[model samples]
Target: MSLLRLDGVEKTVRIPDAEPLTILRGIELDVAAGERVSVVGRSGSGKSTLLNILGLLDAPTGGSFAFDGVPVERLRGRARDRTRGASVGFVFQQFNLLSGRTALENVMTPLLYASGRAFWRRRALAAEMLDRVGLGHRLDSRPEVLSGGEQQRVAIARALVRGPRLILADEPTGALDVDTGATVIDLLEEVAAENGAALVVITHDPAVAARSASRYRLDAGRLRPDEPGVAESDEVAA
Candidate 1:
């Protein structure tokens, strides 16, 4: 089933006393449950803006966007926050972990906004997630003490702790060495698949995008199918 749907989406930012600057135009994309997709784009190609929109961190200025069959535009304020927190997980290349927090504590961060018993059982859940990412032994390790690969693994554990329906990874391997990055990506895909979550990796690297079953290119604020067998007509419409 389709977990995410975006059509004719646009994002524009307004500066003081100036005309709005358009960052994304006519963006169309769809992701199905348990599917793996990738969008490749160069720096300054608006991929980050697209990522924010896809993650529900920012709303589109035009067109329709839906998650789990509900219109995102219809959600307001905290409703949006709850929906995003429950359904979307994010991984960044920089491994945005808290400086002083241990691996386990960092993984438990998401439960801070959680409701019901999930919040109460946060410690066990976090430990389980950390173990899933092979960091159980490092539960007390701080971000500063971990290697690049280890830190990213901790970040992954934190992102997946809530079992988000969609995993949005933005250049997740950017800061690691080639072999380490590949290993981490492999682990990410395996864990995401095991959790039955759709994975969307946004990167400028062709090799990274090639791992996905569906490949698209983002250029000039538009997305087009990038794989050879995928026809131009199959491009995501806007």
Candidate 2:
């Protein structure tokens, strides 16, 4: 089943006395559960805007979006927040770990907003996730004391703690050395796959984009299949 669907999605903002600036236009995509997809684009190519929409952080100005077949337009306010929190996980280029929090604490933080059993078993679950990412021994280390790769692993553990079905990684390897970045991506893919989560990697690096099962190039707010001679998947909008 598809975990996400986007058809003719667009994002536009109005300017003073100027025509509305469109950051994204006619975007179309679908990511099946447990599938890995990559979107590669230049710096100003609306990647972040698209990621925001995908992660439920913002709404598109037009077009259709659905998560597990439920239209995004129908999910309002707290309902939207709950869905985002419960079903989607995000890994960022900056790691985004809290400074004073220990590794275990950082991973446990997401559960603070969770309900029922998740909040009650937060520590155990967080520790399990960190262990899954190979950080079992660094549970008490703060972000300041960990290596770049370790910090990213902590971020991944935090993202996975809620057992989200979709993992959105935005330039996830941007901050590390090539070797460290590769290791981090490997861990990210491994853990997401193990958990049956669909992974969407948004990056500028060709190598990074090539890691996914399906690939697309996003240029000038438009999307096209990256594989040469491969017919564009119907998942792309007409």
Residues 159-188 of candidate 1: C-alpha lDDT, one tens digit per residue:
998999999999998998899889878987
How close is every model to the real structure, measured as TM-score? 0.92, 0.92
- Quote model 1's TM-score: 0.92
Give the per-residue lDDT digits (tens) of candidate 2, residues 1-238. Answer: 6799999999898889988888889989999999999998777778899999999999999899999999999999999999999999999999999999999999999899999999999999999988888899999999999998899989989998998999999999998899988988898788788889999999988898888989998777888888654432223221
- For model 1, the stretches where C-alpha displacement exceeds 4 angstroms are 228-238
lDDT of 2 at 115: 90
